[model samples]
Target: MGLLLSSCVPTSGGLPPFVNPPASTPYGGEYANEILKLPVYPRSRTLDKREFGNGNSRVRFRVEGVNVRMIYNFFTDQIEDAGWGRNRLESEGQNRTWQGVYQRGIRLVRIRVQQEGNSDVYVLEVTFLQ
Candidate 1:
């Protein structure tokens, strides 16, 4: 199932930063920022990606670590530190979702983090709305 899902994200030719990520990612490892076009959570792997006609981008990946809370916190800080607004459109742990929008007009970016059920790995989805 992991293989099937991961492979769904095709490595579009002529694209930079997204080298074919392993269908199955290691639980923990050092994944450099240059390798991932956008900033990624520590030890996360790219599983799927989509770019909309309007230049928006959505990248999906999985991450595994002892602290899901830490992962969520890191994202929050980074997004805001990166100039994203503090407006967290939605946040609900019971639903296991955290999302926010940043950079309004022409460079809008949205980020979301969600825990995938009982699995040790969670999904990190980011949309670059430009």
Candidate 2:
């Protein structure tokens, strides 16, 4: 005989249960500042990023300067340059922002300063949307 709860049971590799709550308040200012203050990221920037670590994740950032390199997964953070090559990004410049999306698996450290210029000081903001 077939089990009555078969339809109600969750199978292996099946989709996870869904639950939705009301939209929350925006996170900015001091609260966001404190999050950036966490031991996850290095020296904070104008738009400090709140890190969320799990396995390995790639952070998406919008930079204004050229020759920009990110310091991802430092020391215990596992921030390395290996995944970057594998997940090479495609950039489409607009205004002062170099827009692109990165995967969720690597901890981003800092934006490596290559050649300094008048506009080299970019407003970096890394958001965790997952």
Top candidate, metric TM-score: 1
Q: What is the lDDT of residue 59 in candidate 2?
A: 47
Q: For model 2, how does the per-residue alpha-carbon lDDT over 1-130 read when each residue is reduced to its tens digit? A: 3586676566564643453444676864776565444344333254322332343344433332112234444343322353233332222342233233345344332332221222324344444334
- Please identify model 2 stretches exceeding 4 Å from their true place: 1-39, 42-44, 47-95, 106-117
Instruction: Please provide, for model 1 over 64-125, each residue's C-alpha lDDT reduced to its tens digit, 9 standing for 90 to 100.
Output: 21111112233232212234464353344534545656664455556565544333344556
Least well predicted 10-residue stretch by lDDT in candidate 2: 109-118
Leading candidate by lDDT: 1
Clashes of each: 0, 10
Q: Which parts of model 1 have CA positions greater than 4 angstroms off?
A: 1-71, 74-83, 89-93, 104-106
